[model samples]
Target: MAYSHVSKKNGVAYYLHARVTPTANGTRTMYFFAKEVKAGDDVTKALDEVPAGYIVVESDATGLPLLKKG
Candidate 1:
């Protein structure tokens, strides 16, 4: 499962997702969600609210979350 972290910038809350890649070298990457959420929000619940048509994937090299058009 993917996990998310909440960060605030310029009064806006960003949901960052971390995902692990399945490559020979385990890599992790951080992806920024398209929208800003409320502060102190739950990461897991925020993930479920990701906008439609977008999917979270892992980067082969960095193992970070990659936001892609799906």
Candidate 2:
């Protein structure tokens, strides 16, 4: 899972921070989690199941943008 912040300037663009790990398939893999802005400005305490073999491209989920870049 990963955490990111929303752009204070744009308010729509997202800045993603993902976790990267090496895979045996000869390709690098990355992953992240999605959460809403809650408890004031903290990310949600819970996360949903992200699809396997795919990174989170974009999540206009709530306020924060959950994006995955590899």
Candidate 3:
């Protein structure tokens, strides 16, 4: 199952996703949250667990989920 976080302010659920992009130096992975999982999404893939040394946080103003280092 995909890792999900519910916002305390809005009660909206967000699923964690990881996106990989190629750079000049090398490839980098970025973590993000979305409401729904996209079909045929090659660049972004849903994460089953939170990455090590990271935690999820929600915005107080918008209730959007964010990844923070822990």
**Which is the leading candidate under TM-score?**
3
- For the record, the alpha-carbon RMSD of candidate 2 to the native fold, in angstroms, is 10.4
Model 3 residue runs over 4 Å out of place are none
* TM-score, predicted candidate 3 vs. hidden true structure: 0.91
Better of 1 and 2 by lDDT: 1
Indicate the TM-score of model 2. 0.26
| Model 3 lDDT, residue 48, Cα | 91
Pairs in steric clash, model 2: none
Residues 1-70, model 2: lDDT tens digits? 3234444434653333334355787645343443342232232232334444445443344444444433
Model 3: per-residue Cα lDDT over 1-70, one tens digit each: 8899999989988999999999999999999999986553878899999999998888888999999999
lDDT, each prediction: 0.45, 0.40, 0.90
* Poorest stretch of ten by lDDT in candidate 3: 36-45
Model 2 C-alpha lDDT versus the unseen true structure: 0.40
Best lDDT among the predictions, by candidate number: 3
Query: Can you give the TM-score per candidate against the true fold?
Result: 0.37, 0.26, 0.91
Query: What is the Cα-based lDDT of residue 57 in candidate 2?
Result: 46
User: lDDT ranking from best to worst?
Assistant: 3, 1, 2
Residue 60 alpha-carbon offset, candidate 1, angstroms: 0.4
